[model samples]
Target: MHKINVHLLGHMSQCETQESSHDSKSKDFRQSDSYSVNETNHTKAPISSTGGTNNKTVPQTSEQETEKRIIRRSPWIDTSSSESNSIHHVVPIKTSDTCPKENTEESIIADLPLPDLPPEPPTELSDSFKELPPINYGQSNSSLGGIGDCNAYNAINSKKRSLEDNETEIKVSRDTWNTKNMRSLEPPRSKKRIHLIAAVKAVKSIKPIRTTLRYDEAITYNKDIKEKEKYIEAYHKEVNQLLKMKTWDTDKYYDRKEIDPKRVINSMFIFNRKRDGTHKARFVARGDIQHPDTYDSGMQSNTVHHYALMTSLSLALDNNYYITQLDISSAYLYADIKEELYIRPPPHLGMNDKLIRLKKSLYGLKQSGANWYETIKSYLIKQCGMEEVRGWSCVFKNSQVTICLFVDDMVLFSKNLNSNKRIIDKLKMQYDTKIINLGESDEEIQYDILGLEIKYQRGKYMKLGMENSLTEKIPKLNVPLNPKGRKLSAPGQPGLYIDQQELELEEDDYKMKVHEMQKLIGLASYVGYKFRFDLLYYINTLAQHILFPSKQVLDMTYELIQFIWNTRDKQLIWHKSKPVKPTNKLVVISDASYGNQPYYKSQIGNIYLLNGKVIGGKSTKASLTCTSTTEAEIHAISESVPLLNNLSYLIQELDKKPITKGLLTDSKSTISIIISNNEEKFRNRFFGTKAMRLRDEVSGNHLHVCYIETKKNIADVMTKPLPIKTFKLLTNKWIH
Candidate 1:
């Protein structure tokens, strides 16, 4: 008998040891009990003996007994007879020989059939379970049962297929997730909305009149051979005109190398378009580059003051004087040049290689205006037998005609048409002059001069307006409404104000808007100074933000343009309803709005009225910050003294009698300060020098400071924004 020992193996241990023992003791265990254990659990099976063995019962050998004892000792195998009906019950087989030589362990094990086990219950998979990627189990090193190995290989292959299918599904889902993420990362496209208004169209319609053009630009701007020929002819005509006036010594042409380059002045062309569409060209010297030492102190020239013009207009309206406008042709060329200067010949004149020596004053010499002033002044005083006014060199008068000269533009006043004609004929004979208006009609005549349209009704009234100027500069608005179907309201008076935050804008956009605003404000300023007294305050306010502008400023400028366009037809009229007073009256209404500017500075507004007709005005921000309204008023009064003196002198000279000059204000405290004799009281205030000046003027009787109610003060329109009703009322009072 052989002793046998059974050892239990864990699940992970290989079955190679069991196979080796089975092969080595194949003969010894031929007649032993037949039972086996699988990798997962124990199973029982019954095996029959070989065919040659006898069916008779034989005595059990020690080996067989040992095997039986081992089987009984194994806890995994069920040996109870009462559990014979169980699926796992092992049935003992009867054999004749204890040790059979004919049969081997492999043959015995191969002959047994595996018991049927219930299929594993379908596994319940969790939601988090993921199928792993397929893994290749190439081969096994264990020498276990062939059937078990084959079955394990097949099961792995089935699981691998399942994992492969799950991996494919995960790849598809991942691609879908990535696609969704990509869409969210993309940017969306949107359309920008455009804002439009009538004022915008009006601004776009303004085309600045070209005053100076280069030779090439002139040719390019004309765009046609006839137009080009016209400019070319005008160029030749200007040169010829200069030659006839003996402006330059044409016979002594000097070589460029022979003259000092610094002494030689460069020349350019100045182009102008007449109302009749005639193009006029003038060859002007670049006198701005000339050194100041090249000329004497006579370079300064003075033109007629605006107050003089106003007085003349008032006198004409009162006395029914014949009025005429004359334009002096080539006035600057008629004078003689003092310094020895040379100029490069203009292009297309066939003298490019030569420089013309200037003999008489050319159009652009540093002293040309003074030379012309001297020549015209001498002509009027010496030749025309007219006496020059005492304080005004540009104004000349005689028993018959009085003339006012503003550069080349001249206005003539006379008691009859013959007297005006006599002066016009003398001017034409001495110098080439154009009679802009002859004053030949007894009813009414319209004259345009210095951007002002004057409509005079004999012995009735004189209406001054800028309808033509506005129309020529800014055309009418014929554009459609906004595309969004929103109708913009008509702009009324200028808004309350603009702040610093609203002026912050992008650099490029701010520059463009500022340029547009400059143009609009320039036109407004011209209108305001000449005729439209209502726009002075608005223009002054808009001028503060020209350098740093935003969308709000631009919109406000557009509104101002719209308002001016709507009131273009309005005018300032001087009526002759009553007989002229024995002596003229010069009245100035001055007001101030304290702490209204962005930096808390004050604004001052001044209106000069001669016999109740507007002559001149000023609206500007004060240079110094004022502490109180009285200080601001004192500053304004001081500033207006010069204007008042000028008006007073002009009126006295024109009427040949003493005139009264009065300054009206809405601040009673300011009037009291002006009339106060105790100057030390306000010496410590902010109005130091200004207060002193105001006291001196009031004490000397140079300015009469009076107080009026706020509602009655027309200068209120110049210092602050007013309601529509008040604005219109004041506007009508100042400008009829």
Candidate 2:
């Protein structure tokens, strides 16, 4: 039998009683081999079963036999051999770091399903190898005195290379397990040692918290360290702003009872530069957003040129009026959060294991802006005696002044300086105010906003004047290609760029490319909508290809860019265009080309004129398909009536009475059919429903339906592609 030092702490009495009975016989034993003496008198596994017993003991009862376990060896390190076991180590499984430290051996072992043991195990032992006792895998290294100090752990895991062949487990002689040499288990230094099963390395040794960066990013004017300093400064600045806003009460939520980890939202500081050449750091909360089930509402940017024309008209109407733009600082924070929400403290802010409950709306949150707008809307409509413009809640006015809310941007109009003071003071009490720009031009018109310049060619007549620096971005194109022939997902045309190698298209990368193309298409569309109305048709056709643009489609986009560059000199001409008649009102020319799209739908064209100049126009698809030119034109007319009525209402809101306007159309047949007294012509139910809506607008809004020659119609340029001569004549005579 081998000499085994048993660090027995909790179960000493059972082993001592069994060994005292076997001590009378003499036995031979080795010195170095370690083994376990069973504390319970159950299925006892001898260290070397071939060794003979000095005395033949009586068999134990079935209950003790059934309860017998523990393979007479330490579960953490190999002890059956003089050297380390080259085979598997009998150790408990490792667990996640987040596992609680207070778990017991039984608690930990209960989770592991009993693994299937192989049956061919009698080569080394005869029915003696015992079952393993449960070992807690969560034990700390400090609690277990150097379990990894074993030779197996110290070695380079090179047991295979060191041996010429695989080591086999060998049976020993009968004298190896002489029963007289077996001693009783001794009491350990502490009771805790026996319960401590498997000791893994400490949590600190597993993962380290990284404080410094591994690499630095390059910047133009600042070094990596300097940029980091700026970022830290910006981070602190944002923290201060949040503190000032009373966004969260940290002291209240610091209690663990009040804040649950599952309920806590996450927040972080975001850094960016502004369009006005300034740095800004904003803190945002990542609250789990529930789907909005309330009434739909939105914020809108008041058109700059439209506002400019209105401001000029205001000046023309009353020279004493003043125009200015104002903004609210941290507008989103003014509204309180209506739901129960909590935000975790930002990492690296040193907030000690705490989360913050959100009290106010936060920037970059999904629905914060909408809530803030609602909050402000309530204040303006209820408290300020202001009425929203027809079809536009963003533009609010009373008898004193007009207030336009473009998110944070506000353009205020007043009759005098005192009125402007009252308006500013009233808004200042409700919000943190910043005056972006304020002035009134008595002589030469000075129009400047949105980094865009405006050229006043004549009285109240203006054009968008882009800066030389801005135009420098667009290279001059003498010969631009037309984009009429390309299709979006057309199959297998030879591309300038190959896709097999050097240009493999990953799905994600392809989607990103398509998104970039879509953004460019949007930029082109906006420019067309605001200034270059001539390019509207071209942009709409290209926009249809945004989802699955092929190489040819991309080529078409490049051609459109070049074409825009070629006609960059063309500008949006905004001026007062109402005729000098007894009843001053608008004249809208509307038309439609049926089946102009691939979807068998019509393209709508609308042109509204006021004070003998172009005020508003659109080249877009009709909302519904129309089988006839008359239905198409009528749909086109239905779309324009709302816009014309809105314009007339704006003028009327300015204390000017706008009477009935003329809606001119080139389709005389369509005009004659609508004016007919026969209601039977419109009784197709669905068609009749749409026709009745049109009929109601024609009579209800007091609009005159007139017809003109197709050649003379100003809206004809938008319906289809025209010859260069006719397009030039139209541009020179009317559109320009």
Candidate 3:
């Protein structure tokens, strides 16, 4: 008979090594007890020797010995048993000790808690449990929600799977967390419910939950919120009423009160009809009339597009400088028609069926835009000695300087300080020029016109801050930067009536409209500072006409004027006791938009200064007809490139720092075509040559082309009447 005794920690247990020992124990304990304990120990020794070494060297540290015993006993221990036979392997730190300790079956059995037992007669026991397999780490527990099905016994003994596989399984499980819960990860559609839940959850999650707000804070929040609501309510009401009152009679045709046939023929190259009664009938200019510069019997087209280019160029060049835009109140009234054409009398003013004779140019005349361009170009070039750019017909020249005219607006760029001042002063004398003098030169005004707002500081203008209060008034205009309003005036004002009143209107209707107009101007006036209106003056044939007099327009103008007035009062403060280094670079943006007619187009002209002066810029339509917007813009840019080259040369000649020039356009396709040297064929003979030439210029000039959003394109305003908001935004780029 044989017995095995083991001590693990403190508890002791005993198992019979031989069947004879188990049989004897099973018989009478009294008979087994008769056997000597020394005899049982001696009998067990032979069985232990048959298995492994009995000279077990126990570790001095109980923890270390326990781990060693578990590792050694792992194979023999039944992993399926209630007690887990797991071992945590620890890498031993490298050291220079060379003593190796022996591990034996007896040592494992001794380490296990076991009581001494008497040996009995031989009895056979099944050894099937010794063949149990080790388990992988992942298979260890179904209670832990493992992917593969695993029994408790196998799971307890399993070794862990590799890290990569473990992570994959974890990801799958986490991905399905929301689906398993049948609830969305995002908030539900009902925001109110979600908010309620969020509030409740927030309270629960707060480190130190606060169930109520302080009494004073609650009262203050309520009062403040109420006041804010009241202000918003008042603002909405006033704005809505004014907007509702703004109506125009688009169906009715309006006629001018006076008609001079000779002026009409000379300006429009069209005839007029006589009235049945007296000559009191108003004359309306025929927009489709032919002119020497615009329409011809052979070509049959007008050169208004040329004026658009000139306007854009001028505005772009004078962004930061004073831009005194002037309108010849009754521009055609000054030019008598040379030809004699006939037309029907005005529907409203005419008596019996009498036709009107020759007359002055009116608002709707087709050749009116061209005539205005011709008049201004002649004055600037012929009188001022300003030479026009050859390839681009939009440019004109003054002595040692150049003046670009876009109908009512003009931009002046000079070669030297003397020339620049001389040109500015001369133009001021010719037109009703209101020199803002916001900055050092005319280029500053062009920059501001390109959507930069200018603020005067110490005899110079700085770009106004975008966040100024004037920006708040932008959205009121019903038009984009290109004034696209069908109704120029509300129902009360009748006919194609142009208000040329120099005296301020006191009535609410007129005042309200003016206020609105001023809002746009105000917004445009802001650039790097608040807007000022003190310097704002009306430029019209009529001593009274402020072009933008509608409440919406006036509001915009007032704000802008105020911005200017306030800005002029300010002085620049340089805390650093050294002269600041100035950037010597030039930026120009050019773009174009097609008109209501497919053949007609508008152009955007822009230019920027690095060291605060006009470097280069031109916004103009293509001389030849373009098949697409891309082609037209490319032509404009091509024309601008040469101007820039000349400008750079001029700057160098002026003994100024070398300027790094840049060309910007809003058309991605045009930029791509120019950069990649892809030229589009134009069906129109006039535009085809220029289109190809433009592509060549863009490639040859090494022009730095960039794409800009329309909102930021300073040329936009030059091409069209901008809505108050867009106008205001664009105004900041050039006017400070």
Error of 2 at 106 (Å): 98
Better of 1 and 2 by lDDT: 1
lDDT of each: 0.58, 0.48, 0.34
Question: Which clashing pairs does model 2 show?
Answer: 1-176, 50-174, 51-174, 577-610, 577-611, 577-612, 578-610, 578-611
Q: What is the TM-score of each candidate against the true structure?
A: 0.67, 0.58, 0.30
Ranking of predictions according to TM-score: 1, 2, 3
Local error of candidate 1 at residue 281 (angstroms): 1.3
Flag regions of model 2 displaced more than 4 Å: 1-237, 253-263, 286-321, 351-353, 381-385, 443-459, 464-509, 566-570, 576-584, 678-689, 723-725, 731-736
lDDT, candidate 1, 546-610, per-residue tens: 65344555555655665666567778877763523354556777777654554346678887777
TM-score of model number 1? 0.67
Candidate with better TM-score, 1 vs 3: 1
Model 1: lDDT of residue 663: 71
